[model samples]
Target: MGQSSSTMSSPVIIPAAARHTATLIFLHGLGDTGHGWASAMAAIRPPYVKVICPTAESMSVTLNAGFVMPSWFDLISLDPNGPEDRAGIEKATNFVHGLIEEELKNGIEASRIAVGGFSQGGGLAIHAALQYPKSLAGIIGLSCWLPLHKDFPKEAKGNLTTRLFQAHGSADPVVPFHWGAETSALLKQFMENSEFKTYPGLSHSSGEQEMEDVKKFLQEVLPDN
Candidate 1:
């Protein structure tokens, strides 16, 4: 899926049946493609919303038993001290920004777009939305960690009063619920009324409740038509 020498391919526009200008740009996780979690659409479907799902550049997924799969970067280790692929990170940032610009060009306001993802993709969405320099309609992360290791610049934080919906299973092994909680806290520390909910017994997979939460988030963030 490396259409360019970057960590993210261009957005694949999936038009909703209604001519809604709002967009949800979804990024998938490690070992997954854009289509991997496309089922999220059904959970999010409302009249007049378009969703863009982009595949990450394919890289050999070493942590997942060395199987080659689509991924944003190599997680040298789970430790903070581990090496990181800076190039991949930069490419991902650029690709996400490019998608936002293109969506605005297509007539959607910056405030009409939300970014959501699962796992590593979720991490990217958190980082990207925090730096997006304008208020988003919303941001959602499922089964992913917060990218607070990188600071969100002051200007973006000032403009980001947008709603946030984050759901993580309390018993998730890959991404602990605490991560989501901390991200929510951090967001509220800078913005207003960011929402975070944790499912008590759910796992890394998005439970039905979490998907329902996404609908609620969209209902709260999207403009009433």
Candidate 2:
């Protein structure tokens, strides 16, 4: 339960219970703060991993009628295609990338660090992880799709060895399940270690089954000594 301000808008961090051998930097969805998902530390129960949940800067969202809220980037539309917010996404990508570098400076290798998120944050996780220059332990996305997926081919080589665990509720409406599948399909072409799971009757959020899967994924990718 310690806090540090790496940026004007910093994240809520839960230090590892045992030795801090790994870092899990997770992003929050639109309109949510880092504290919103801070409980993930307990849910995952990875004693060797430190959890970092960064808060997104407040900004007006086009999908929400331009009302300002905490968002990783602006959503020009929910069309799953253009009118994309390229500039905003790039800024957030760099912001998250900065967090990765901080962990690296603290002695955590890129292969021992994981990045994940829900919804908008999940999409950014996929976008940023693909563009990151080093291989990561894993990438998790819950009920989110890849933003700018068509451009992934040119960028796939950045983290080809990074594993992915993406799950979507079949009934997800905000970010349709089909879109998530499409992203998983494309990722499998270059990211051979990726896996996508489906929750038959869930919605836009997660539940016990999904959390269990995440725990297993972390244990597999960020194993203890």
Best-fitting candidate, scored by lDDT: 2
lDDT, candidate 1, 1-225, per-residue tens: 444564455555678668776888888888778777665764575667788888887776656666777887666556543566666665676678888898899899988888888988887787778767777788887877655344544535433676767778989888767776766776677766566788999988877778877887777777666
Question: In candidate 2, which residue ranges exceed 4 Å CA deviation?
Answer: 1-8
Residue clash pairs of candidate 1: none
Alpha-carbon lDDT, every model? 0.74, 0.87
Worst 10 residues of 1 by lDDT: 150-159
**lDDT of model 1 at residue 15?**
83
Count of backbone collisions in candidate 1: 0
Candidate 2 local lDDT, 1-225, one digit each (tens) = 212234347679999999999999888888989998889755685898999998887777898999989888788876766788887788888888999999999999999999999999999998999889899999999999888787877865477777899999999978889999988998898887889999999999988899999999999999996
Candidate 1 global lDDT: 0.74
Clashing pairs in 2: none
